[model samples]
Target: MSKNLVEVRGLKKYFPLGDGNILKAVDDVSFTIREGETFGLVGESGCGKTTVGRTITRLYTATDGQILFDGKDVTHLNKKDSKALAKDMQMIFQDPYASLDPRMTVEMIISEGMKIHKMYSEEETRNRVYELLELVGLNKEHATRYPHEFSGGQRQRVGIARALAVNPRFIVCDEPISALDVSVQAQVVNLLKKLQKEKHLSYLFIAHDLSLVKYLSDRIGVMYMGSLVEVTEAEELYKNPLHPYTRALLSAIPVADPKEENERHRIVLSGEPSNPINTLAECKFYSRCPHKAECCKAGLPALREVKKGHFLACSNADALYVDNQGFL
Candidate 1:
């Protein structure tokens, strides 16, 4: 059997804005999640990171594509089949406050999924909820309280517990640490890493935090607008980024050490994001690329491999590395 827990191919999601206009939110994206690894998806806001997670969960159907889960093509399952598919896959949403139900207590929040799936009896449900609450660093007492009673970080732990309640094999961590304090962010990340190890869970971890991605991801994929421009082993991506957009994003990560910060310079990118409607077939970063060329504005470049595992989507991936004088 293939080692991949999830496989996505030619995924496309588009929205019509009326009058012959369309917004290509997620266009022609493809990736894979191995059985127990975190496949990090990083991009700026409005770049369809959230849309990818939602599309995978079938919250929004793809305009065209394939979603393979555990070797099955569950891409277009109907409501009945989809509900069954959800048993093995779950998602932890980005916004803890907004994602939680205001009227429900924490116990109801976590147990509702188990009840819908008919996974437990009423007595067993409460016990499962208690176990999950403790697993996510929350106590049994917190289960009786409303979402408003906890801090942002606590509410997110509750969300994590809810996702785990179903005992899913695959989980989409949609920026689960983004809305928390810096200290708490690491805690949440560590919790995820621990949970993955203990449960043998596979994750499609989406985030814009470069530092966190470097820490938690086995492989990293960089997205610009709605397209993946580069994907490589996490350390290799930070060390030898191939795409200009990836270079720019990596350069933007702040260094904690002053000496290291002084040694390496940051790349400064200009120009606004391209129109998602994709009126032109050019490379999306061409408008702001430091090493722009006339050829880049004509057609979209297909992803190419410079090495065994590194994939880059740029016509000028190599050209930007060296100076004009040809010195490395």
Candidate 2:
């Protein structure tokens, strides 16, 4: 087995409101991404998936918990070490247009990281910029153009090129294809897969699209409210989802075949997601879970392995099984 390139343990990022309330954007989340593997994080909007990615890249400081990168304790890196960490870790933002500076040329945007890290000389940086652009499917001539000149797909290619500039070992892909057209989304996903194979890069991919996540991820983690509810291999997750939220999510993925799609039962979950502000120690999905038992209300279940290579946080698996038989 490949060694873990990144390990996040009990990670938490809480935002303080003006009042006494505290919003737990990420609460006690933990996972590991092996070298050259893609770990996909999926959930509904406002589920703290984005916050986990940002915190891992150090764009946002953590409220508590530890982050280890390549066996180094990176949770509290000094200035010098932090600068070194920048070269090893990188992020691709969701908004391709907003992430790239309008005033800068494509060449400038792609070579910025290399120049900051002093990775190459000026001539080398320029040559590397052209190479990266080509690697991401853009040509050398486009380097002189500004962000406004490119289409959404082209702009996203530029963003991908920029992320690759430093030759990072790991990247946080924060919904890199969410804003693109359906045709373009596949192209970007393929590009990422191609790059990962060529460069041996690990990814922490965060997205709401479950089908896309399954296609690209080696393993998957399902998040809800502020915590991870289930984690397992990508295929195993779709084949056997133990958590109620996971079942609901998988059931909602649109089937490609019209006949099958029409025939399949959809698990329509009711009620809004629970508020994250100072929530009590109880199952957050209690409001919408059809399998909820009195035991679920006692305290928040800690994520533990239920079977080989599968981890779950739900305590009422029997109840889930009972409901699965006829609840759909």
Q: Which residue pairs clash in candidate 2? A: none
Give me the runs in candidate 2 sitting further than 4 Å from their true place: 322-328
Model 2 alpha-carbon miss at residue 118, Å: 0.8
Candidate 1 lDDT over 111-147, as tens digits, reads 9999999999999999999999999999999989999
lDDT of 2: 0.92
C-alpha lDDT of candidate 1 relative to the true structure: 0.87
**Highest lDDT scorer:** 2
- lDDT (Cα, tens digit) per residue for candidate 2, span 1-328: 9999999999999999979889999999999999999999999999999999999999889999999999888988789999999999999989998999999999999999999999999999999999999999999999999999999999999998998999999999999999999999999999999999999999999999999999999999999988999999999888888889999999988888999999998998997797888587668998898878989997668888877898989878756653454333
User: What lDDT is reached at residue 67 by model 2?
Assistant: 96
Candidate 1: which stretches are off by over 4 Å?
318-328
Single out the weakest 10-residue window by summed lDDT for candidate 2. 319-328
- For each predicted model, how many residue pairs clash, with residues at least 3 apart or on different chains? 0, 0
lDDT of each: 0.87, 0.92
- Model 2, position 166, has a per-residue lDDT of 98
